[model samples]
Target: MLLQGGAFSACNLAIIENRRLPGWICNAAPSGRLGRAHSSRVMSVATGEQMSKPHAPTHQPSLANRLRLGSLADDGLSYKEKFIVRCYEVGINKTATVETIANLLQEIGCNHAQSVGFSTDGFATTLSMRQLHLIWVTARMHIEIYKYPAWSDVIEIETWCQSEGRIGTRRDWILKNYANGEVIGRATSKWVMMNQDTRRLQKVTDDVRDEVLFYCPKELRLAFPEKNNASLKKIAKLDEAAAYSRAGLVPRRSDLDMNQHVNNVAYIGWVLESMPQEIIDSHELQTITLDYKRECQHDDIVDSLTSPESAMTESVSELQGSNGSPTSANSENDCLQFLHLLRLSSDGSEINRCRTEWRKKPAKR
Candidate 1:
């Protein structure tokens, strides 16, 4: 779903509050697909306090956008660098709603994977994977949850831009369980303007105007932005992440495939090295979504990130071990791993953008 441009603010430090519910931002009711079993449902969540009343369901809004990741980060939740994964009855739950968090992910992280619509809301609302330069700012926005319990209602959702760069912009957000703080989900995403015709990254000659769209729009000409070597690492802004534990591993020739780039799935094995051995052995992955931005090569000095936000961003997950450890909770180094926007000097060219995210389902010990 898309949102409109509202406000923005950058996050300085990660937040670590014992919040039961995430803060509320706006209200949106999604319209289901045609010929579906059920379309839309008016939801009353045991979540949090409801603020303003719905103006009127004049017309089902288009995919919503127009939000900066900074505003989401500026708030105390600070998911741009961290996120919460609550161990619930069925599965872990994050407090943030899908729309708000999705918007933020578009702004803050490197979303090279096109949003290809989720299975849960395939009908009326679903995020489809599209090229970065092809994305557009959502003109209107609203979210409706047809299924519950299985689908945590986005009790409250908000968006923000964590950072803005010479060529690309970063967004972040939070999804809270209105039913209190039973769950909260946060995310970060990034976008680069492109020449609509060529589907190539382009420089922004005009101000965001005349229908600044998200899923590929038309532009005059192709102009590349001045690339830089800056990394958009905002780890210090999250509260739910633990101190990172580094590990060293030797790459096997099998890890090196054609293209000489490290095979994508090989990174998960790298992350597993840093996680608790027990969880690695016991947990069965229930839902795994890997977003591969940059490829890895054999024998490179790679840092295997098993952190939650890293796992979520990269799609390589480790099980729940540290959350139970006070040491884990207490260790807040404010060190963010630089993932995206690695620039090379000389001509200021882009090497590549690399990041990962994952979620693990633990086998009952």
Candidate 2:
């Protein structure tokens, strides 16, 4: 279902007509030929969604690393290190389509990483989808939910990078029909380059930049902006008080990633961890937007603040109005809040600044 908000109050969101999604393709056979017979429909990236797999994990979080020495199960494939990551199973949602995010990843040429975080917005407009589809995210692109008209629940996603870069790259995904040959969705992504040592943003070099030009389309390979600011920035201080109204600690070496900066998505872990499990279970987000002002480095102390102003209505429960305490204020009204996340380096340097907004809806139960 489309976002139910009415006109003027609604966000203008467009998705490919459902008929445009891919049908299905059989598994690759032992001979290594793709699609012994091509389907009647040729789904294009601009028109449809496609569909795959992730890594073996350790209890320890991972850091970014250079090409490794044949550690990936040496089954002897030509492109071991460059294998496409598939969506074995993703909780991808339809309210926010997966195709939109794939396109975002396609914009960044490879040798890049997912740099910023993204979520649905509070104030919707032409700029809403444009910012998400055309820009880098500050956090991990999550699969909220995915389903098509014909299927029960076999959503497949295939993710791959065209090439690697010092920090940026071209990436794309195919959302496919698991049992048949169909392209249900598609995604294009872009990445940001960074200083591996300082974890600061870095300009891509001519050699590395030129290499990405091959896989990137003309529009996808636009001139890189120093930052993703909608307007020129006014300097905000790195002070402790202005920092936030809560805090979290990062005491792990693995908290660092290949770029030497904390991986962009790691902060989400911090945010969710700070909130109660009941809050997550009760709320369905209307929209969430993230802006990454700086990077959190190794051993940095990440501070967080959940403002009473941005609090979600569902997060609070009140006594039945009749027996209310005399000093009690109305809890149901004005329960929304703004969350401030302040991450700092071990040396007390402000590393990342973020603001998260939430709206609360009552639990159906």
Q: In terms of TM-score, which candidate is strongest?
A: 2
lDDT of 1 by residue, 1-365 (tens): 12222211111000001211111222111212210111111112223444344212222222331221121222121222222322241333322223223333333322111111111111111112122223322111111111122333423444433223335444433444455533233333344443334534444332332112221212211011112201232232222243444434555887663334443334444544555454434332222223333334454455443444443233112113311111111112321222222222223233222332222332232
Tens-digit per-residue lDDT, 224-246, candidate 2 = 12243211222233344432334
Q: Report clashes for each candidate as comma-separated counts.
A: 90, 80
lDDT value, candidate 1, whole model: 0.28
lDDT (C-alpha, whole model) for all candidates: 0.28, 0.32
Q: What would the C-alpha RMSD of candidate 1 be, to one decimal place?
A: 17.2
Deviation in Å, model 2, residue 196 alpha carbon:
3.0
Model 2 scores what on Cα lDDT?
0.32
